[model samples]
Target chain A: MSTRTELHYAFALAALCALDVAAADAPVAPAHPLDAPAALKAAFAERIGHPVNVLSFGFGEHYAQALVQNAAAPDEFDEYEAVPGRPLEPGRPKKAGEVDCRKKIAFAALDLDAGARALAQARAAAAANGYKTPDNVTLGADVFCNDFGWRAILTSDANDDAMLQIVWAPDGTSPKAQELHDGGWRKVDVAKLLAGSAKVAPAAPKAEPKTVAGDGRKRDFRRGIDADLARLEAEVGAPLGFKHIGIDRTQLSVDVFQSANRKRVSTWLVGDDGAIKLWREDDTIPFDCNKPFAAGDFPLAQLPDLVADAPSRIPPMPQAQVKDVAVYRSGLCGRPHVYIKLEDERGYGNVEYDERGRLVSAQIQ
Target chain B: MAKTAVAKILLALGASLMLAGAVAGAEAPGTDYGWPNLTDFLKQLIAKVGAPVKVYKLAMDRDGKVDLWIQDQAHPDLVDSWEYDHGAIEGPIPVKFDHYPSIAALDHHVIELTTIDFPRLPAMLATARTKLGQPDARVVFIELERGDSSGFISVTDTPIWTIALDSPRHDGRVEFDLQGRVLDVDKD
Candidate 1:
């Protein structure tokens, strides 16, 4: 063969090799940590200072399969079935023998020393509440806005005894209060009750005369005179008008204010055509006809520009992001659903879309 | 003419045979030279080095990238090991396997150590030394066979302090100094 022919063959071989190398270097999805090297186990143990086991709890069955691939002896790792439990529903009572009670939500157990330190901290918190633990007293009931914190419910057979339950904020701020439920646990608006109790007493009322002596004929004549006056006013097309009836302006104003307060704030405008229109505001309060009309409801044209710009006047589209992406299969549902978690600063905001990609009711998870 | 052509061929063949012999002689242990498995090798090394230098547990470092350990006679229970890849360490240092064959000859345990950054070994060793004190150290290099008909080699060097490996095969020829603490390893 000529030198040129040899060079051509060589160039073709080189091109093929380059393509092969590029194909080999292309990035595939990364394997889960279990399929990782035995070295990873050692690193985890060192970091956590305990025997660390990475387990899959929820709907991801593929994770277990991935882990088997990297096992040193092929299936040497221990596998345990997660206990079946009901999905958490807001305001529902926790059932007896629920698997969720046994589920280990914490990443890892604290070492002995760390556990001791935590216990000491808890003791210090308990002492600061002006009540000792294992004490007996009837806790005064009150309601306060717990809005975003954990409140514990402590119960004991001793009817008058009370324990301090610590309410903790996510940012580590915690306050302890004595438990107060007597028969059944009830949630009360403590702030409102305390405000009502702080009001001062009112003054006494005056007595009125029981009777007056009058001739029956004079009474009948006076009544006839009143009826004649009313007839004369009706003929003239005008009724008698009061001059100084000692009107209570304060009470009248208060009645108007109360009626306005009962009214539901205007939310988004639903067109007469029955289509829900998108608004530009952050929040929308739905309009209810049962509520008394308030200042919130002026004609859209009469509203101030700022108020009109707000979400109640014009509802804004929900803002969301993909917080976590998990793939799950439902035999009955038939199709795989990609659960794209969207969350703001709130713990777990509403999941807006359903399996069919349509807007559905928001569920707080 | 036939005799001359034959002689020319003979001379060429002779030169080639001699070159092959020279290359074989220069081959590193665990390559051309044979070494046993890592577990057996470690046992033999500990026996040769003598007691008080104990080998306890072993672990791969973060992400299986490196192997590191600490060995102290005072605390036989505690051992530290760190492993790193070529990217994690500075510079390219070829794994030397001469010291490994002798260590392996003592026992039959084999551990595959892939090519790693030499500088990372020292950094990890420094940390272990601070925790476990200085000890004699030795590195065992092994060649791993891949499924693709290609082979990649790695080394696992143990910093063993005060312990000495005495054997007729080694003849005290292999040794390394870690910050003035010298570990005399058997190269043979």
Candidate 2:
């Protein structure tokens, strides 16, 4: 390897702290060590000896499925269902003699390339020490985000008691305190765990609060409102008509007046810190009275006609077809318009319908 | 990544280690690499990983063996490991695992074992919202994972779901169960 690559690898390797603990540094054992729920964490930290990204730290069976496109073939996506052997879906009935109890599972995401190397290293090490690698894991990046390098997860039971029949932790227990524990709910004890325990998992990364120190914060907001408005005005110009302003302890909202009277207008939440949260001038509040309707409100049968009838040139499309239509009532504009997500400047446009099947307000987005 | 860590490293490697008066328990470890304990070594390691956050729990088991995982700030699982055995904190090489247990691997039980699927995501979210009065928190991401329920002790593979959300009112991630029950609320 080149000196540069060797130095980089050395630096990366040094980044790793420590693995197995030595006998000399062992802390004085508790006079009486009990197998409490906390034992799971202690053992995991002991085995891994690294700061594992605990995904979740509670109990309940959970899973999901999403489509991830093959990088080689961008158009081809594969849908993988990470399901339980016999999962209990929503609204499904529990069966007799069912062993479905709340168990903790911690998982991590690995950088595809790094993961491959790590896996190879692990396999070599495991083989040297009598362990085998599993088969058929390509280690592809997830759909949500691929920039992440790697992730590690583990699970442990919160139950301190060691009764096999006890599916859930005791009601008043500090560790596995569930809302309500009923029959068929089981909690595992750490003593019974094999190498990979089957009881508890770590929690996800904690999210950032809106206010760092109560100075009014939000997600994706811009630096300030005046600057944002100026930028929007520069882009949309005369059409940038916002006429209403509302303020709360945390947020300062502003919107456009549908009618000159300003009675009916859609609301936009500019960050209380005076930042613009979104580039759009509209409110994305799922179901606002201002935006009474959405893409889902319309009938399925009308989708084809709506797509075909949507004016192609009114929005002034350079070239491209409408891939999807999101219909919503623009309370600020005082009209029901369809937001079109296009395939290219002609790519996307919002078309407001006029009487007699004519296009009233069609603008490129 | 953290200035304090770099200072600690540089100070440890300098001539005449003289931090006995600066901070209580600042006496460096008797070992060659320095640092009084595993915790200090971890502080430096955390900085190297581009995360300067507090490093909690550099624990050793009863067998005189300590182990742990340190991913970058992002949750990608590029994992590396080092073992300090019987107070051999200063020497011996470390092990860098190319792969540890991902969600899928944990479910499959090659590297480790756990319940197949821990907590169903959407269902718990619906419950958490109702219990929380359905606050207008912008949900950045909702992840269903199986983690150790009680981390004070051993690691048990249990089911749990974390809903990372933010709102003008407040911001934090709420962890819940499949029945839509709130387990804990971690304010970020």
Candidate 2 lDDT, A1-365, residue by residue in tens = 99999999887766653222232233222221121223322432343333333221222122222223223433222232222222212122111112122121222321223333333333333233222332212222223433122221221233322112111111211212111134343444422332223333323455443222223445222122344445434433334444433323345454654333334554444454544432223333434443333212333234344456555744334454555444334455454443444444213455544212345566544
Clashing pairs counted in every model: 40, 116
The TM-scores, one per candidate, come to: 0.15, 0.19
Worst lDDT run of 10 residues, candidate 2 chain A, spans A165-174
Residue A211 shift from truth in candidate 1, angstroms: 79
Docking class of 2: incorrect
lDDT of 1 by residue, B38-156 (tens): 33222233333333332222222212232323232343322223233422422112222222122222122222221212223233333333332223322233112111111122242
Tens digits of per-residue lDDT, candidate 2, B115-184, equal 1121233334444454544344445555444454222222535445566555433355677654556788
